[model samples]
Target: MAYKISEDCISCGACESECPNQAISEGSSTYVINPDKCTECVGAHDSSKCAEVCPVDACQPDPARKETKEALLARYKKLHP
Candidate 1:
């Protein structure tokens, strides 16, 4: 599954630099994750780096955008390729 930033986000930008895939970007109000580029850090790290570093716990799995590990890996490949 891809990670998403919640309204709790303070826009501290702490999560932005933590995203290994560069999926997180500044939005009008908060940071937004590009689902097409998000792999939840699967291919790059053992866990989601954005969630790991977000102080407010704003980063969480997008319930509406679920995907299996296989699908995540495929997305990772597509982004890097």
Candidate 2:
């Protein structure tokens, strides 16, 4: 599943550089995650780097964008290739 930035986000830009897919970007107030480009780091890392590095734990999976590992990997491949 793709991750979403929550209100807990401090707008510190901590997660912007960590996303392998470049899915995260600065929003009006907080960082936003592009669900179409997010892959939960399936092919880039064993786990989500944005989530791991988030100081406020604002990076969370979006249930609304639920996806399996295979699907995530496919997206990663598509993005990387």
Candidate 3:
């Protein structure tokens, strides 16, 4: 599943650079992840880099935008291919 930044985000900008796919961007009040671009770091890393670096643990899986590992890998391929 793709991860989404919650309101708990402090806008510290910690998660932005950690994202391997560059799927995250600054939103009106916080960072937002592009679901189409987010593969949960399936191809680029062992885990979700944004979640790994978020100090506030604001990065969480988007239930509404869930995907299987296979689907995530496919998305990663599409993004990097």
Candidate 4:
């Protein structure tokens, strides 16, 4: 599933660099995750790197954009390949 930054984000930019798909970007008030580009690091990592490094645990899955592992892997290949 794609991840999103909550209001709890401190604007530290930690998740931006960690996103292998370049899906995370600075929003008006917080970091935003582009669901179309977010693969949850499926082919890149075992878990979400952004969530792992977020200082305030602001990175969390977007329940509205739920996705399966196979779907995420397909997205990863489409992006990387």
Candidate 5:
């Protein structure tokens, strides 16, 4: 699933450069995650780098867009290819 930045985001920009797919960008108030480009780091890292680097723990999985690991990997492949 894609990760979403909550209201808790500090606008730190830490997660901006951490996204391998360049899925993250600054929004009107906080950094936003583009679900179409988000693969949850399935093919890039063992874990989500944005969640790891976020100081306020604003990055969290989007439960509304649930998907399996294989699905995420497939998306990652298409994106990097």
Candidate 6:
């Protein structure tokens, strides 16, 4: 599944740097995750690095974009390949 950053984000840039897929970026008000590029760190790490490093816990899975591990892995491969 792709992850998203909520309004709670402090725009600390911590999540941006930790994103292996370069999916997180500073939005007009907060950090935003590009769903197309976001693989939830499936190919890069065991967990979402953005959530791991976000100070305010603003990064979390997007319920609307929910996907299975196999689906995520497919996306990760498509992205990296």
Which candidate wins on lDDT?
A: 5
TM-score of each: 0.94, 0.96, 0.94, 0.95, 0.97, 0.94
**Could you arrange the candidates by TM-score from highest to lowest?**
5, 2, 4, 6, 3, 1
- Could you tell which candidate, 2 or 3, scores higher by TM-score? 2
Candidate 1 lDDT, 1-81, residue by residue in tens: 888899999999988887777898999999999998899898889989999899999999999998999999888888788
Worst 10 residues of 3 by lDDT: 13-22
lDDT of 4 by residue, 41-78 (tens): 99998889999999999999999898999999999999
- Give the runs in model 2 whose Cα sits over 4 Å from its true position: none
The C-alpha lDDT values of all candidates are 0.89, 0.93, 0.91, 0.92, 0.95, 0.90
Over 12-73, each residue of candidate 2 has an lDDT whose tens digit, in order, gives 99888989999999999899999999999899898899999999999999998888999999
lDDT of 4: 0.92
Best by TM-score: 5
Local accuracy of candidate 6 as per-residue lDDT tens digits, 3-81: 9999999889998889888888889999899998898899889988999998899999999998988888888898788
- Sorted by lDDT, highest first, which candidate order results? 5, 2, 4, 3, 6, 1
Residue by residue across 1-81, what tens digits does model 5's lDDT show? 889999999899999999999999999999999999999989999999999999999999999999999999999999988
List ranges where model 6 is wrong by over 4 Å: none
Off by over 4 Å in 5: none
Candidate 6 global CA lDDT score = 0.90
| Residue-level error in angstroms, candidate 2, position 55 | 0.7
* Cand. 2 Cα-lDDT: 0.93
Candidate 1's C-alpha runs over 4 A off are none
User: Which candidate, 3 or 6, has the higher lDDT?
Assistant: 3
Q: Which ten residues in a row have the lowest lDDT in candidate 6?
A: 72-81
